[model samples]
Structure formats: C-alpha cells, structure tokens
Target chain A: MTGSPPAPASLPGDDLLNRIRALRDSPAATDTGLGRELGAVADPLLLHEAGRLLKGVAAARLTRAPATRATTLRVAVAATFTADDVVPLLRAALLAGGVDAELHLCPYDQLGVQLTDPASALAEFAPEVTLCLMDAGALLPRDWDPSALDGVRTAVRDRVDAHTAAAAGFAARTGSAVLLHTVPLPRPDRRSVISFRGGAALGRIWREANIALLAAGETRDGVYTVDLEALFADEPGPVRDERQYRFGRMAWTPAAQLAYAREAAAFCRAVSGLGRKVLVLDLDNTLWGGVLGDDGPAGIELGTVYPGDCYTDLQRRALALRRQGVLLAVCSKNERALVEETLAGHPDMVLRPDDFVAVVADWQRKDLHVAALAEELALGLDAFVFADDSPFECGMVAGSLPQVDVVALDGDPACHSTRLLEPARFAQLGVTATDAERTALYRGRRERHRLSTTHETAEEYLRALGIHVTVGPADAYTLPRLVQLEQRTNQFNMTGRAHGEALTRRLAGDPGHLVLAVEVTDRFGGEGVVGGVWLDRGPDRWTVRNLVLSCRVLGRGVERAVLQYVADTARAAGAAVLEARFRPTARNAPAATLYPSAGLTRAEGPAGDDETVRHEARLDRLPTLTPDWITLVAKEAPAHV
Target chain B: MSDTMTTLRPLVARVSHHPAESLAPDTRFTALGSWGSLAAMRLLAAVEQTYGVQLDLRAYMKLETVGELASEISTRLSGGAETHAG
Candidate 1:
C-alpha cells in the first residue's frame, strides 16, 4: 500500500525548529536511508521540516512494485588499463541497479587483434551489450613503424569490412541489435597519427563499416556506434568539474556513479522501442513557477527566484532538446488566456508558446489530451510522459495511461532546483548542433500551423508555405541530427526506432541499407532535419521500413517529399519498384491515406487493421512532383556511419 | 483487473493533493500539487500517475503500519476538513 502525508504549514525559523522537535517526538517519525545520507543531527530533520511548507495528501493504499526486472543483458568489456579498470566498477554499479551481465574482460593488444576476434567470445557468451573501455594509450602508438602502421591500418579496414558482412549476415539470420562503443582515446602522444587525423580515424573506421554493409544488400541490420565526447560535453558544471566528482582518489566518484547510472537508464530508454521517439515535459512549476491564472503574466515569478530559477533552467534544457531535432510537446493545464499572455508578453518567460511542437492546455482530461495530441501530431503515446506539479495529476496520468511516463514534482521550493535537474529523466539519446535551435524552430512551426489555419483552404495554405525538402543519403554533417531525430521524434514516425552513433558506420560498411534524412524549410524558418528514412536497398527493388517525420512539419506535403525522394533514389539505383509498407499503430493512422494518396497500388495483405500493408509503385511512371507545395532537393549526403 | 482499478479511485483521491470530492477516477493529478520532481521520482511516474498514488516510501520505512496509515487516512477523510495530507 502507498502512504504519504501532506506537507505541513510553513513556520518561521524558530517555530520550524520547534516543530521539528515535536515531529521528532511524534510516533510517525522513523529513520530511513535519506536521514543517514544527511547527518544524524538536523539536516535530515531540516528536509522534513522544509516539507511542512508544501503540504501533501496522505495515501494509504498506494503500493508500488519496485522495479525487479533483472537486467539480463550480458556485456563484454574491451579497453586500455585506465578504462578497463573502471569496467568492474561500472559492472558492479549496473548489477546493483538490476542489470544482469557476465563481464568478459579483455586487455589492450596491439593492432586491435582482440577486438576483431572478440566476436568468438561474444558469440560463445551471446552477450547482450558490449562496452569498449578505450584508454588514451589505445589511441597513441608507442613505436612508429611506418610499414607496420600501413599494414595494420589496411588490416583494420579489411577486418571491419569482413566483420560487417558477417554481422549483417548474422543479423539477417538472427534479429539482434549490435552496438559499438567508440571512445575517443585522449591523444597524449603525437605518434598515434596515421593517414587520417587521429580523431578522424575512429570516424573513418565507423563509416567504412557502414559502407560495407550498405553495399552488401542484405536487410540484416544491427550495428551502432557511441560518441563519448558529446556525452561528457554540455553537462552541468558540478557534474563536469572533475574535482567535485573526483571523490578523493577515484576518477569516477559516487556522484559520477549516479551520473553513469542515469546514462545507462537513458541508453536503455532511447533504445527501448524499435527506436527512440517522444519527449514529455512537466508544466507549471517545471516550465514556470506559480499557476498561470493566479500569478498572472507579471506575478508568476520566473528567471531568478530560487524556485523560478530552477524552472528557467529546466526550460533551457527543454530548448536544447529541440535543437537536436527532438519533437517537443506539452502536457500542462492553465487558463488558456493566462498561459498565452505569459508565453507572449512576459519578459522572463524563457519558454515561449513556440517551443512546444504540440501542447494540451485547458482543463481537459490529461489522458484524453495526450491521446489527442498524439493523434493530431501522428505520434505514439507510449513514449509520452505527463510532467506536472501536482502528485494527484501525475498519479491520475500514470494510472489512466500506463504506457506514458509521468514525472511528479516535490513541492519543496528549496530542493526544487536540483530535484528538477535530475539527469535520470531528461537525458537525450543523442545531441547535435541542430538540437540547440529546436525550441525556436518549434515556435516557427507553431506559427506556420496557426497561419495555416487562418487560410480558408488547408491545401492552399500548405501550397503557399513553399516547403522545400532536401532528402539524401546520411553524411557526416547531417549524421548527428539524423540519429538524434530517430531518437527524439515520436509522432508521425511509422516505426519508432533509435540507433547509436555507430549507425552511420554500420550503414556505410554494407551496401544493403539505404539511410536518408530529410531537411524541410518553408517561408517561416528552416525546420532542420525534419525527418528520417531507413530502408533496404535491393538490386531489383527498394523496401522502406522506417519513415518518420517531425510533427512540426506535418500536413505541409512533407510525406509527399519522402515518397518522392525514395522513388527518385530507387530509380537512380536501378530499382523498378519502391515498396512502402504501412504499419498501423495507435498514432500512425495519419499515414493510412499516404500510399493510396501517393498513387501506389495497395496489394491485399493479412487482413487485420494492425497488420502491415504492402504498397508498390513503379519508378517509371510516378506522381508528378508538385513544385509549389514541396520541392525535393538532394543535399550532399554524409558518409555512411 | 477491475477491482485493482476499482479501489484506485479512492486511493488516488486520498493520496492526491487535490480534493477527494471533486477528483474522479480519471481526474488529472496536476490539479493539486505543483508538478515537481519529488513526486515523479518517488512514484516512478510510469504506472501510478493515474491512481494519484506513489510508492509509499513512508510505509516502506516502517514509520507507520499499513493498517495504521489506512485508518489515519480514513479518519481524516471522514472527519478532518483541514488541508492535511492525512
């Protein structure tokens, strides 16, 4: 059963101390881990004392099933000494957090012989995850043997090529996701420099693997790369500062342990569904402090106060999500007028109405609101979470909608800052330069939508927007955002899927997969990296399985651009038919009219509505490109991952 | 499944910062407490948001027995009109 008491009334400092004494004497007072974390004396007592200001509701019957799912993912560790030593600690931490794994430890060897053959050990154990703990030493060459360097580089490239083919073959035979961890070895010595710049070697190898697989022509997919540099970047000051996180002699402190745990959780979540999509946010205290109506535009404290300051920081985080090509939406309630006023005119409102790709405001039922937003935006609700200040609301949202993630706020104004800044819930699958401009672009989308509504005819409105879509193979500059969109976008995504940084590398290693990203720009602003498309390239035909669009660019002939891009690319590649499959999901009904409207012939399929529908269209005679609504321009694609 | 959800309405109202009288089985949880991290982390927010209840840490701590908590909440609902969380 669940039981929580409401926060008591706030008292003056002296009264608060007195109340603390009385509560300490009360029969309800009990010692817990939290108290131990604080000193035995008054810190823990202070926490409870602070709780009194924001009263809580007592619930006796609320019982929670602590997460007991055993993490059955076996992991293999390969790296140099420094990183290799950290593996035991990482493994222990994961085990404590419910991960089930048998650590396969390997030492650093010259020319990556162990890595190439690590497959044999991996095959034997059938590990679910592999961690390549690369040390700075692995990156630097000890003795420069020019002939040996050339021989080793060639061998490394060839080995990657051979393994990619085998892995693609293995994936076709067995449906399993393969991930590669690409840790940049700190270049302590200049000798590691080879044909390409040291940093570029990792990038080049990753791409070679992708190209090999793309050329192989097997639909066998399951390869991804990890980017460590970006992960450590953009973190909070205290988290980034090595001194604070050092914790005495250890490089990774207890706080770092918490950070790593949070990273693992994010990694699991991003890859939870077929791919990562959907980001949910809390409104009120999270987006801004105080109720919209009660505080009014001027009264609702934001930007600088202790509580409001925290909310502002959270808004900045949300903005960062958008810049990475993530789709943003709101599950908040307020007087529509007040919220509008605050978002529009308030100087302190960091997050304007434009930041959200979609929003559910007003007193409507939150579950219904989320469902409607999912439908309108054409996204899956499974990735949705309702963030709100009230526990009652979080509880209702969680109970009524089991699939959605709900984040409840503790009302203590003091702890409000760090509490909201918890990295466990807000981590993104990938980060990119495009991620920084997301909030502003989303605002532009909202403006376009509003303007689209003002037009008498929806189709005419779309045509007038002059949307231009650039679609092409994934290349270096676009690869970061492409992976990010795959991880963050939810609505309008046919197959919600997320891949790792190594996705480009794997794609480049094989010839079978055709990976493409879409960039849409209308008169309003450049909605960069609006969508992503992944398909299997066949000698005689092309089959697209995953196609997702940014909710911001929906209803503006963007889907048409996707079909047109695939058709053109397939034709150029000597494919006759471009087969598009529509998988019915709770949120993707918006795409039901797609194949038919695009003039594709729908063949009879296994009859259930949820069953995948197969559609085929000949490349020779395709629908005319509507230049006014959408102009499909091909951009310089990035080298495969 | 039906009974599991049946007792949920009252539990939600009891645990919620909102009024028990107005809150329905399907009412939103944000009407009461401010949307903050304390509640989200405590509840894990994925399964229990709709029920307006969190994983009772206080109960897990042995501060109060389950029966004592239920009786306390019942007494509060039945008589006390103050804005105490029970």
Candidate 2:
C-alpha cells in the first residue's frame, strides 16, 4: 500500500543493503537503483535507516537516472526545524519518481529569512521550486485558551501572513514556484484541552489557519501545495515525535515525514512534467473474472457475483481516472465482434464502447497495438501504461517497449485498482478545465516512434547475417537445443504444447513420431538447433504435431524448406495427405497463417472456438522451396542412435 | 556488553563517525572529536527510534559516556513514558 501503515515494519532488506554497499562514490553515476528500492519503503524506521546509510552521499552526487532526461531542477527547502534529516529521504523519493532534483536546504529555522533576504543562500541558489514547510507547533500559541478564539486566530494569522508574504515576494523576485503544505495541528495543543467546547474551538481555529495559508500561497503566481491535512485524514498516524520535537524541534513523525516526502516528490514530478497519459487496459480476467473466449460474453463473471464485483470495482475506478482526463484505451486479443458485443450488452460493465479512446481487439501482438495507439494519438510510448492480467503480455511489452510502464493485473481482482494507480503513474499537481482544452500540449513532445515501421524494418538489420540453414534428426547433440525451442517458441509454433525435456526424449524413440532439428548459422556464429518439427505418422495422413521455429531465425525466410522437407518425407513414405492443427489463440495468429502461406488451406467446415482448425494439403501438390538467400543442408540421425 | 549497549553503540558510531568497536562503554560522547550539537541531535533521534525511548535532551546531554546513554535507554525501556513511540 502507498499509504503508511500499521504496516509490518522491519529493517531495510539485505538486497537494498547490498546495493547501498556496492554504490560507488562517483559523482557522475546516478543513484536510480537506490531510489527504486527506497521508493517501495513506507515504514518510517526503515526509511530512516536507509537515509542513515545514505547519509554521507551529497544530494548533488546522486542525480536521478539520465534515462528520463528530465532537466535538473534547483529546489530550495525552507523549514521551521533542522531540515538536514529530510534531504536524503526527499532525494531518494524524488529520484524514485524519476525527477532529477538538485536540492538546497535553507538555513535551519529561517523560513522567513530565506524567503525575504535577497542575499540569503536560498536566494543565491536561484531555485526553480522552493519547498516551504511549517510546523503547527511553531505557529500556534502554547497557551490557547478555549475562551480566546479571536486572540488565537489573530496570532495565527499574524505568524502565517509574515511567511506567506515573504514566499510571494520570493516567487515574484525569481519566478520560482513555491510549494507549501497545510501544517498539521500539534497533538499537545489538541489534547491540551479535552472538553467539547475547547476541542471545537481549536479544531475550528486550526482549520481556519490552514485555509488562510492555502488562500495566500496557492492563488499567488507560481505556488502549489501538497495537502498534508487531507493526507492525514486518509492515513492518520502520529504526526510528531514529541521527544525529537522537545530536543531539536523536529516535529514530524516517521510516517508523516515519509508521506510529506513522497507528496513533495510528486510535486517535483508535476513540476518536471513527467506523467503517464494513456492507460492501455487488457480484457479477460482484468475486466471480468474468466477468459472471455472460454466463458463467452454472457457467461463471463461481471457485476452480479463474488469475484465479478471486483471487476466492477476496477471498472468504476478506471472511469474515475478518465474523469481526471487520463485517456483510456483497450488492447486485447479476441474476435473484435465479440468484444464489441460484450461492451454494448453486458449488464454489469461500468465502462462502455464510447469510454475508450480506441479499442484494438484483434489477433495481432498487443505491443504493436499499443505503439500504434500512441502514434495515432501523437504521443510518446513513455506516456502510455499497458496493464494486463497475463504475465506473457506484460513481459512482452516490458521487454520490447521499455519506455511504456507495464502493470500486471494478476492475483486478486480486488487489489487491481490500487496496484494500477498506486505508482502515481499519472501524477499531476491538479487538473483544470484549461488542461482539457490543451490536448495539443501533449502532441507537442517529439521523442516518439512511428511504430508502424519499427517491425517492418527490424529484419533489415538481419540482411547482413549471410544466413545458412541445416535440418537434422533430433539426437543427443541437438536434443537440448530442440527441447529449449519447443518450450519457448511461440509466434512460429503450430501448437503451444510447451514440451519439456522428458517428453521430447520419450517422443524421440516412439517411431510413430518423427522429430527434425533445424539449426541456423549466420556470418556472426551458429545459432545452434534453433528450430524443430515434430510429426505423427498415421495410415491415412501424416499429422505435423508441432512445427516450431526460434525467433532468432524467424526473419531469415528458411521456414519454406522446413515445411517442404516434412511434406516430401511424408509423401515419399506413401502418405497421401499432410495436415496440422491451427488454433487461433490470440498469440498463435502468426503461426495460423504459416501453412496457408506455403500452399495449405483450411480443411472444410467452420472451426469451433474451443476446437482446433485443421489445415491440410495433398502430398502431391507440394510447392515449398528454400529462398536463394539461404543454403539448406539436411542431415539424418544414425539408425536407432 | 548489555543488549542496550549492543544496540546503542552502532547508532552512536553512525552519528560520531567512529567505528562501533572502537567506542567502548566508557567512551565519553563529548570526548569524541566529531561530537557536536548536530551529531548529538542525530544520535538522540536515532536513539529514540531504536529504543522506543523518549529521553530529555538536557538530561541526555549531561551524561558523559556511551555507557551512561545505554543505561538511560535501559531505564526508559523498563519504565517512564513522557512520549514513547507507539
């Protein structure tokens, strides 16, 4: 949970400790990894320990990762107490959120001086953003009598006005954005009087002071706030360490400090203008309980039952995010007809067809769909977040499209909304009506892809491979490579059996099955036994049980020889027909067309959704040939090994 | 060394920039060359968090050695709750 607990608090993990130890004292290297690990931390003691470990490292030395390329922001921190303790935590949190901050902590207990004095160190730093923190304990009178509400209000106004004016003056002088948070009410003062009358007066007066500061600071030219008062109501814990306060005027408790630091980092992110815009959601388990294909439109779990409510909850949350101006899009694999049918007709579905900016429910790989979505919207992949229930899809997007933020909507459907939204992936200071009109504001960023051509030209890089292909029987040397390809090969695989080593070994001796290992060698090096074909021999027809090719050799255009060899072997052995199962799993679309492209056609009637479609060809009509660019060498295993 | 001393020594070392093993029970906090107001405040903050003990800053400063600091932790760990952590 992003909110601080009553969470199980423990010391920092050994992994974090090891990373801290391995960190070099180099000025150039960014502490991005350290920031990532610390970002997951919520417990005050653990974060404090991490800060203590990172105490010696100067904030300047630990710049955020250069991957984001956000320009370094000069931030000045002015607080009521000694703020040295806050810098490490703030730096870690800022770096975690991908904001590269160069922080300057104003002199201890000089919140007003730093804001007003032109010759002060804070003014010299020339900050882009100034984080101004206040303690209620420092602001409110110690002896706030229940009778003197007006007097306490005057004193609070007098103390707050001085700093607010100084802050406005500073922003006017330097065009620097000033950030302030509503100061929390001190516990001593809150408990100092217990009657209903006393409590009511204090609560009323305290809120007035907080609102007064908000009024003065935010309405000014370039000032914003991280609302601590609202944050406390959401995740309430002790706000002050009275002992620390008594000793050094350090009022914030560990959780309070962390919450403030995290929100402060969010402000920094908003200032740096790094936020996700498009949320690419997947169907099946993510939007409903079960696979849509298996359950059918009416059969899938939705708003009426146990786990279905969870999906509804997530859908409701998605609509809420859309209201905040985060565009929603769906990227899923299904017959587009069924997807549209369900969206239009489903009784429990909170989202409708019109809610999404685009719906790409097709058989193509989703990474391509997401990229096309971005290009269509004229934004960068960095601005997109792809969330899916399947780890395969998540892994695919994360590996190929590293710029996109991928969220796995696996595990309990109940926590799906929290998991998707928790990173503050779409953090913005506040959304105004003006922002809705400013859609062109995002189209303006040019660090984007034409993704339409990324894949079509990917094979262009392979032209220099000087490719060669070799097909041999599956045997001792080639068995390991063949087994790996059978388990891992997906797009080019006829059947997704994901066969293991034992199954491959057992099938090798079964005479009824024939396994051929295909290897590719390029100018660079041999790619081992990177392709494999498994066949089952029957009296009437020989079935190609699985024809799998490794991605390493996909673009080399050698699969024709592989298919031709199998057809000839079956035909020579007196088999009249050659056939293979073609299942259109969202993933297997690329494989389904492999046989049709090589002169095979679908057998007869329409295939059921669950049943496999059979593609067959007369053995005599074979017309597959290896391309001129590839030289094929066929080998046979020794008789009976 | 006492359990409190075992827990307190490393934290003291952190603030003072001295090795934990080098700072014995009798090593005076003020005697350390690095001991200053900032270090003292840091040590107190760490001490309060580690032991769940809320110590009087004035009284804590009056103590001379690491042993005395550890003893204060032991006393507070047993009884006394001016403002202990939950």
Candidate 3:
C-alpha cells in the first residue's frame, strides 16, 4: 500500500471504484487506508457499501498480523448484541485516527462476565482500554410492558446500575480505562405508549436513566461516558431500524454507527493523552471567505451576511475552543503587516490578534512554523492539529508532520466548524489549569487594536498604551525560558544555533558573556520574559551571539530597547564597537532588517561567509537610542571587567 | 442474466468474496463452508437497502436459492405485504 493514497477529485464513479479495487488488491492493506477512503464517501448507502468493500480487505489484513507499532493501543470491546460487524468499523476508525489498536472482542452477551472475572480471557488480554457497548432493548426485559410506569422505572434502574457497576468494577479491578455511552431509547418503545402524556413520562425516565449513566461515569476515576442520545439529538438521525435490529442484531443504523465510531476514536485518543492541545488555522479561505492578499479587508466576505456569516460562525467556534483552554494560532502564507492591520482593525472579525498565542503569518512552510510553535510552547508535535481550507496546504502539512492531525476544510465555509470540531480532536475530560495566570491573562481582550482607527499614527497609539519594559541579567529563574527562546525563536532570532542550558548559564553568570532577559507590560496585561539577548564582552568590541524575542512582543518597541541596553552597557564597559551577526534562515527574513533599522552600519566587504552578514556600530557614535514611548526600568548596574 | 440476477449476483459476490459468475439461480447460500451468518445478513442488508423493502427474518430463513431471493424481492416490489412467505 502507498500508505494513504492521494484523495481523488471526486469519489462517485470510476474514481471511487478504482480506489476501492486498488486498495483491495494491495498487500499492505491497512484499516487506516480503508477508513481514509471511507471518509470520502458521502451518501449513507454508498458509505456502507464502500465501507464493506474496504472493511473486507482490512479484516483479512487484521487476521494475518497483530499490530506491533508503538502507536498500537490495546482495546477490549464487549457489546451485548451481535457486534461482529462493529469490530471492523472501530478498527478502521481507530487506525485512520493514527491509532493501531489490538482489539480483543468478547463473545456475544458476555459483557459483564468479560469485564468482572479476573480469570476471563478479557483479563488474559489485559487491554489498556475497555469499551462497553450497550443496547436498550437488550437491557430491558422482553415481557415488560410500558403500562406500569413504576415497574418500568424499577427495571430501568436495576439494569442501568448493573451495567455501570460491571464497567466501573472492571476498571477498578483491571486498571484499564472503560468507555460507555448513553443508550438511545428505541422509538418503537416510546411510540408503544399511545398517549402523549405517557410518552413524555417514558422519555423522561429514559433520559434520567441516561443521566444516571453519565453521572456514574463522573464519580468513577477510570470510567468515561459519552451521551449518544445527546449526539443523536444534535445530529439528525434515526437511532434504530426494526428490521436490522430484529434480523441482524444491529440495534443502531449506519448513521448511529458512524457517529459512535468517530466519538469512540476521539475518546480513546483523549484518555491516552493524544488529544490535540493547539489548533493551527489558515487565514485566507479558512478564517474568511477569500484570500487576504487578493481580496482586501473590505472586499473579503467576513461580516454578518450570506457567505460571510459562515466564517463568523467558525470564528465563534474557535473562540469557544479557546475559552475551554485550547490555544489558537495561525500559520498562514500572507504579508505579516497586512495580516496585523486586518486582525487589529477588521470590524467584522470575531477573532482578534489577542486570541492567538502565536501568529506565523509570513511566507514559510506551515509545517516548519507549526513545529516551531510546538517548541516555543514547550509541547510535542503530536499535541498540535492543523486545519486549512486548501487541500494543497493540508497535504503539505500532513506529509511533513504526520504526528499533527490535519482537518481538511472544503469550499463550504458552513461545514468548516463542524468538520474541525466534530472529531473532538481537542476534547479532553479534565483540564487542570496549571497556568491560571496565563488563563487570566487571556480572559480580557485588549480593544486598543480595534481603537487603532482613532490614533493619527501607530506611534500615538503606542504612546497612549503606556508600554513598560525591564531588561536585566538572567538569573536561575529565567534561564529555562531563555534557553527555550534560543532553541525555538525563528523570525526575530539573530543567530539560529542549537543552544543548551550549559551555554545559557555561562552567558548569564560568567563575566565575559552577558545575557539579558527582557520582560514586557502594557496597558493590556503582563507578558513575562518576552525577549532574550546574549553577548560576548570583548576587550575593544562587544559581539552579539544571539538576540531573540518572542513574536508576541513584536510590533512593540521592546526588542529595540533590549538592543539599546546591550549597546549602552557594552560602551560603558570600555568597548570600542558593538558588533552583531545576522544569520539567515528560511523564516528569519524579519531579523535580517532589524540591525539596519537600529542604525547599525552594515560591513560592506564579504561580511563573513555565505550565511552571516556583519553589522557594526561604533560605541563612540552610538547612533541609536531606546524610543521614549517604551519606558525601560533601571535594573542591574553594568558589570565591567 | 435477469435484471434481478444482475444486481443479486454482484451483491452476493461482494459479501461472499466469490465471483459474480460463480453464483446461479439454484445456488444455496449455505452450500459454501465459508458462507456464515454474518455474510448472509450483509447480503440481506444490501438487498434491503437497494430494493427499499424489508425481508422478514422468517422469510429470509426459508431462502435456500439465489433465485428465491429475487422472486421475494419482486413480490415486495410489486406492492405486496409478506405474501411470498408461503
């Protein structure tokens, strides 16, 4: 198998048939490959047919070899009915979501025994997660009538408690996480109660029973419950088909299976700690209706109107995710200044610049920038998910960073939010707010950017905001962040070397090397330790090893003040010249112009090798000074040799 | 092949992993050792979904030949209710 095949233009006629046949013929037929193809089919009947074809190949593959990948998860599924067909569907879903699960399925109606008994084969299998699937018809007694409401209530309570106790007991005994779902009440059962009043009472009892199921999961440590009825309510669908249920023992329809399979995959990933922590969005057709460069701010479709309302809904969804503590960021291919101006002043935009943790809006490979973001946030690449409307960009990011989950949005902005969140890619159970301060910082949005229209110049706005900065020597407290800046900073980093804690300490503590930590605070909030400066205090000329600042503090004058402080300290320490090196990276073009903007003269002749350009300013001349708008606090005295 | 047979052969072939040409009107679904209940139900589902008719389990159990399933589907498609069971 060519792992995951390139998605076809359209998936109905010869194209879809050929893909199914090709995947069926391949020797490396995996559940992931089959599921990926299954995602393309839209119609329910066609989806089932394609799923069957692809699942046939995967079933044969499943029997041949056991999964040995590090991504392989050990899962045990115990369902009440004949769920032989369910095994393949779950396998496809889990594998496509990048989990190779070694599934252990119990015999029919063996859910309780398989869960509770230590001597059982399920115990022998010793799964990491046990999924307990249920059916309401199977739980309720066959002879029971809905006429006696009290008898109905008693039977429901006993059955529901028994099922939950078995699942919770299994979790306690085996230490494997258990996943259960709210059983959708059969429509026939509801319609059995002829009177409207009786039907409502029956519905209320079933709902309370399902709530008990959910509440039971909340009390237990290793058990999780998903509300299938809630899901069925949100999504339009029939819960069951009488013929299928009676004949095939499949209580749920294809729609129910598809929905449950998706949520199950997300639950398995979330409990395994593989859920995404960051959602990287594209700007052009994703955030708005058109391209920012091609269609100017006013020209874009992003207000409260026909097509633009779709984009606005998506922004609201992203804002909701951020409120739940999932950090939002942008990795787009557009001009940074244009993006900033739009993000700051676009009245139609629901998401402001303050919403994003990092905005990498320059023309760089999105994969590289996403990786940089993961490093800057001190997280793993697996914790990030990238969503884009362009298939080209999605393919690139998916190819380069296979760990990151890719949500490919299509032409319809209406479906974008649903596609992005339906998988519950960023959903988690309990979010411990480890950084309460960070959460508080993001609580209130700074409306000053929206007020930029009133200010005559950008400087006047800056002056009104009252920005403050403190540049001091790096101590034990700020060394880790400084080292992170050295490793992670790209655009504003003067030197792109792999620096470790040892070198950072030598720069901070040693007399010859000086490391400065720049902290920033504005009228909005406090941004802790946003910039770093590493310098070599030479006899006659001070050399700058690295000057890296967080992109969050860019457009502000914090970086300029840090540079000025380095120059002033070096000159007072008897250095004749302040020299700096500009090393170029694919992402560091913004850094290339910084030296000249600070009034440093570029050395003409050869300026070192192909990569590094030399910039020097005579300490006696001291052409640049910190701007008055950014007030620098007097901290550590300049330590001279 | 009849139009019913044309559609029936392919569906049975897909579920049973046997070629369409291998199926005929007199073929018993259980004649092949590999043909299990699961495959039978899938074929039943495919038929039900394609023809938009429900084949009762009792009627389905009595089915022994591929030709009988076609006649049963035809009976339901002809606006009759469980009339072909006997």
Q: How close is chain B to the truth by TM-score, in each candidate? A: 0.32, 0.89, 0.86
lDDT of 1 by residue, A399-433 (tens): 77655555666576545545543434444444567
Label model 3 with its docking quality class: incorrect
Output DockQ, candidate 2.
0.10
Q: Which stretches of candidate 3 lie over 4 Å from their true place?
A: A1-35, A41-71, A233-237, A247-249, A291-299, A374-380, A399-403, A435-641, B80-86
TM-score for chain A of every candidate model? Answer: 0.53, 0.63, 0.60
lDDT string, candidate 3, A1-641, tens digits = 12432332222333454566776788685433444555444444444444455543433343222221223467888888766666656665665555667778899888888887889999999877788889886566776687887788888888888888888777767667788889988877777899888888888889878998898777665678998888877655477767677766877666577677767877766655456667899999889998899989888888788789999999999888877667888889999999999999999999998788778888888888988777556556766889998888998988877667789988678888889886677766544332224433432222444445588999998898788899888766566567655544656788665344445665677788888878788787776777888888889989887899876567777778888888878877889998888888766776787888887888765645787778998887776667889998846735531
Task: Count backbone overlaps in model 3.
Answer: 0
Per-candidate interface DockQ score: 0.02, 0.10, 0.13
Could you tell which candidate, 1 or 3, scores higher by lDDT? 3
TM-score of each candidate structure, all chains considered together: 0.49, 0.64, 0.64
Name the candidate that leads on DockQ. Answer: 3
- Residue A574 CA error for candidate 1 (Å)? 6.0
For candidate 2, the TM-score is: 0.64
TM-score of 1: 0.49
**Against the correct fold, how does model 3 do in TM-score?**
0.64
